[model samples]
Target: MDVCHYDVQVKTAIKEQKAEAIVLTDDGMNLTAFWTRLLCGCGTDGRFEPVYVMENIIPLFDKSFNYEIVERESWFYGEYLQAFYTPEANKIVIRDDVYERALAGVALDVITIAHEVVHCIQSIVMRFLNAMQCVEFKTAICSNDSNEMQQHELQTDRITSLVLSPDSLTEGKTDNEILQQYFINPLIQFVCGLIKTAGKNLLEALNDTNCYNEVKEVERCAV
Candidate 1:
């Protein structure tokens, strides 16, 4: 789909949700409750259920894995140390620091949670597609290498933008333009290429007519 169509689809999807903007506040309990609704299956009428994995401190990935957690006085970088989706666990784990930041009203921290939620959605779609015999997509899902993982992350980021910033695409901006303006990264070009080859808009695929009732059931619970 072209940028205009993509923008329309994204805006329409966001509008249908009638989502209220998240307001930051000092109330820790309120913030936690809000996030719980956003991430847990409770909001989706049990159509989706993701284990909420939490720890008092950052955890290390298995040594056999290519990713590692790195922490510095200034910051941290690595897969396990940060919030990540583990398909094996069927869970999205948020480290203690990231959770703390969200409670403290760090917008990006909360946005990160939304990003992971998109991964949960993607997992559902992938499983459905795989069952339909989409071998390529199944391969992509099972691949553990860095390149495949990056593709998944970039795809999630694009969907997250659609969910979180539909208003930004109002001025005739293409998806690529919007991505460039707000989320410039080396993976942008490759991610777009992969999406194009798939020949279906993410929203449209997930909103398939056959799944309409199921989707509506989830939305009913969400709202």
Candidate 2:
């Protein structure tokens, strides 16, 4: 499918609760709730403070994969590669420079680690749940088709953002504060702001066939 249809399908999946495996929460829950579950697993106490994902969450979940740092020349992407998850080995390899920056508390680099962790979840948890068989989930994880690849990258980025700084958790927090506290990218924070602002209307539109049809028409025209 083209990007537009792919987008509509994603919205439809989210609305239908077909994305629960990836969201890690029930339908209609805010991103904060999703993050709570993802970060704390089943032992959450309702607080949404940032936690050490590698130390606390991953270990709690028994996903004790090693972080392997390698030279840039180790991958085809070279220096452009921040980090990547190897499903066969169940290990996440980080580029040397990215690892160094993450050690120094660089927000983006830390986010890169979280991004790879999400990739691990996709390969391990989601696959175990049989979610990989779904076309939407498959496309969002490892499809090679151009449209599917875009969806994959988009889903990874969205999951990373949701894990880092959920909308409800951003209350009264400035962009810089969110960056320091959540390691959220400025672009992700801006997009989260728009989504939070439009959330009510977006939910209404999803539930109203007429509104959904109008959105389709707009998408068609734009295409």
Best by lDDT: 2
Write down the TM-score of every candidate. 0.36, 0.46
**lDDT of all predictions:** 0.44, 0.53
Q: At residue 191, give the lDDT of candidate 1.
A: 64
User: Per-residue alpha-carbon lDDT of model 2 for 14-69, expressed as tens digits?
Assistant: 23432222433322123323433444553222422222554456655555565577
Residue 75 displacement in candidate 1 (angstroms): 14
Query: How many backbone clashes can be found in candidate 2?
Result: 0
What C-alpha RMSD separates each model from the true structure?
22.3, 17.2
Segments of candidate 1 deviating more than 4 angstroms: 1-80, 125-143, 168-223
lDDT of 1 at 176: 80
| Window of ten residues with lowest summed lDDT in model 1 | 19-28
- Record all residue pairs in model 1 with backbone atoms less than 3 Å apart, i.e. clashing: none
